[model samples]
Target chain A: DQQVKQNSPSLSVQEGRISILNCDYTNSMFDYFLWYKKYPAEGPTFLISISSIKDKNEDGRFTVFLNKSAKHLSLHIVPSQPGDSAVYFCAALGGSQGNLIFGKGTKLSVKP
Target chain B: DAGVTQSPTHLIKTRGQQVTLRCSPKSGHDTVSWYQQALGQGPQFIFQYYEEEERQRGNFPDRFSGHQFPNYSSELNVNALLLGDSALYLCASSYRTGNYGYTFGSGTRLTVV
Candidate 1:
């Protein structure tokens, strides 16, 4: 069973627009949520993260909002740039060692 | 400094063959975790190693095994490989006490025919 899910396979947006990616989870034990950006032929790079205790966290242009009651979270990139195009994977931190459980990932393309 | 480094960027093997993938964690990181990413899908956890011991494991079968050295480097071994085992193997590193994030390597792509 998939604990985390990202239903959207791809998204297209214009540069300088806001890009929003959504994720949902089935497990309530997940206390931390993270977003990672991956480029072609490369490993995922950490983006932003939010703890279950907090509803929102922001780092520069990247913001993550977590809704514990809904078991859902989202990553928003404001004024998205062309370089922001990549596959974004939503992951949850759980298990005894806090192993990451990742979603299928959403491919975002920003056009100038 | 260098981030996580994985060796053998790509490899191809026949069914039933065995392969070994290596990883070197980022400087100052003590914990290492392995993940497998198939095409068109996200990464799935395999196992984790710390202080030369396997600390956590995922749902992977017995064919997947790993080892960690005294220097904090790691190796992932897959025996009796099947075609379904073809995928990208990634290595991530972080502090044992911190679960905030991980530094990932470029990954090694293994294709089993």
Candidate 2:
């Protein structure tokens, strides 16, 4: 069973627009959420993360919002640039030691 | 500092063959985790090693085993490989404590035929 899900497989947006990626989870024990970006042939790079205690966290142009009641979370990039085009995977930490469970991932293409 | 480094960028193996993949963690990091990523899918955790012991393991089978050396480097070994085992193997390194985010290696792409 897929504990975390990212329904959108691909998304395209123009430069300077907002790029949003959504993820949902079925497990209630997940308390920490993280986003990772990956390029072709490279391992995923850590992006932003949010703890369950907070509803929102922002870093520069990237922001993450979590809605506990809905069992959903989203990553938003404002004024998205072409360089931001990559596959984004949403991950959650479950259990006490923070073992991570990842979603399928969404490929984002930001066109100039 | 050097980030996580994995060797044998690509490999090809026949069914039932055995293969070993290597990894060296980043500087000052002592924990290593292994993950397998199938095409167009997110990574699946295999197991994690800390202090040369298997600390946590996912739903993988016994055919997949690993060893962490005293130097904090690691090796992942797959025996009796099946075609379904073909995927990108990734190694991530993190510290034992603190909020240190994992640093991943480029990965070793294994193709089992």
Candidate 3:
């Protein structure tokens, strides 16, 4: 069973526009969420995270919003640039366990 | 300062063989976690080691085992390799402190024939 799901396999957006990626989780026990960006042949890099206690967290051009009631979360990148093109993964942490359940990943393409 | 580092960036093994992969965590990090990523899928947690002991493990089989040295480096051993064992093995390093994000290595791609 896939606890975390990224419905969209890929997304495309124009530069300077907002790019939104969505994710959902079936495990209600998950309380912490994180987003990671990965480039070709490279390891994933942490981008942003949001705790269940808060509904939203923002950093620079990236913002993450969580809706506990819906068991859904979304990542928004404003003024998307070509450099933002990569695979984005959504991860969730449950309880005190350090393991993170990840989504299949969404390939984001920012067109110049 | 360096990020997590893994050795033998690529390897190939035939069925019924054994393979050992190594990892060196970043400076001052005390915890190490291993993950197996199949093609077109997200990474699956294998296990984690801290303070020279295993603190957590995922739902992998006994064929997968690991050890952490006193220096915080780790080694993952897979016995009786199967064709399905072929995947990219990723090593992540993080402090034991709560809520800290893990830094992952480039990964070692293992191919089994």
> Taking the candidates in order, what DockQ does each have?
0.76, 0.64, 0.61
Q: Which stretches of candidate 3 lie over 4 Å from their true place?
A: B97-99
Tens digits of per-residue lDDT for model 2, B1-113: 79999999999999999999999999999999899999988999898888899888899999999999999999999999999999999999988822348888999999999
In terms of lDDT, the poorest run of 10 residues in model 1 chain B is B94-103
Docking class of 1: medium
Candidate with top lDDT is: 1
lDDT of 2 by residue, A1-111 (tens): 999999999999999999999999998888899999999989999999999999999999999999999999999999899999999999997654446789999999999
Q: Rate the local accuracy (lDDT) of all candidates.
A: 0.95, 0.93, 0.92
Residue ranges of candidate 2 with Cα displaced over 4 Å: B97-100
- Residue pairs with backbone overlap in model 3: none
The full ranking of all candidates by DockQ, starting with the best, is 1, 2, 3
What is the TM-score ranking, best to worst? 1, 2, 3
Best by TM-score: 1
Better of 2 and 3 by TM-score: 2
Cα lDDT tens digits, model 1, B1-113, are 99999999999999999999999999999999999999988999999998899999999999999999999999999999999999999999998834665999999999999
Predicted candidate 3 versus true structure: per-residue lDDT over B1-113, tens digit per residue: 99999989999999999999999999989899898988888888898898898888888999999999999999999999999999999999999834457999999999999
